[model samples]
Target: MIIELESVFNTEGLKLPFDYELDLSAIQVSGYSPIAQPVRVSGKVENKAGIVNLTGNAQVIYTAPCDRCATEVSKEYNFPLEHTLVVALESGENDAFLEVPNLRLDLDELVEEDVNLALPSKYLCNEECKGLCMSCGKNLNEDQCNCKAPVDPRFAALLDLLDE
Candidate 1:
């Protein structure tokens, strides 16, 4: 969603309130496509002293895989976006509000950035997650595996050192 800044640039100390909804369902994560629900954004843009400041709140629903177990997880996320756009003034244009050339703001990119940044680095279905067994590829949380594992000979020196 590209908001036109022409009107804001024309008037000094102008404040415009707007509400918009955007669909951002095509964002990819972990080699899978996760559908991002429609996000509602409402904010005010104010032009003060040749600078445009935008402050808004965005609400989004995201569905993705759990980091630990690769299970699907769905949740709603809310992010607040605020930024300022500075307009470059031309020579001898003090009274005249300088026009911002091709001022376009991408709502999708902004939402994606916020959502990705907000996501936790590690996600598990439960806090006490007993991960899969390394030997037989069994889920340790559900059941234990009985496969005998061989010890690496290189660790013998370290084991002896610890005993000392």
Candidate 2:
């Protein structure tokens, strides 16, 4: 959604309250493989002192594999996004608008960024999750595997030293 900032930009005290819902299930984030479900974003954009201040709340459902157990899990996340966008007088004159085009705000990009920042670095179903057994590829949380644990040959000398 591209909001025209002409009105807000011209007036100092102008504010635009916007409510937008977007479907992000089809969009794929780079590092985060999980896709977000349709999200509701409601926010206010205020133009004060020649700066556009946007503050909003977004609610999204995220589906990702658990880090410990490797099970697919769906979680709901809400993130608050607040940022200042300065309108450039010219297209290439200002550094802020250099990366992004002037006067046009990419709502999709902003929403994607907010979702990415809200995600956790690591996700686990539970803190005490036993994860999976490497030897037999068994889910340790369900049951124990009968396979014996392998010991490194380099650690054999250390084991003998500990015995002495």
Most accurate candidate by lDDT: 2
- The C-alpha stretches of model 1 lying farther than 4 A from their native spots are 48-50, 89-100, 109-121, 126-128, 136-164
lDDT of each: 0.67, 0.74
| Deviation (Å) of 62 in candidate 2 | 0.6
Task: State, as a TM-score between 0 and 1, how close model 2 is to the true structure.
Answer: 0.70
Q: What is the model-wide C-alpha lDDT for candidate 2?
A: 0.74
> What are the per-residue Cα lDDT tens digits for candidate 2 across 15-128?
988898887776554455575567898898888887778888888877877787788888877788787776444555543332234667787788777786777777887779
Work out how many backbone clashes candidate 2 has: 0
Q: Where in model 2 is the C-alpha error above 4 Å?
A: 29-33, 89-101, 147-164
Q: After superposition, how far is residue 111 of candidate 2 from its true place, in Å?
A: 1.6
The digit string of per-residue lDDT tens for model 1 on 10-50 reads 78899878788876676666766555667787787788887
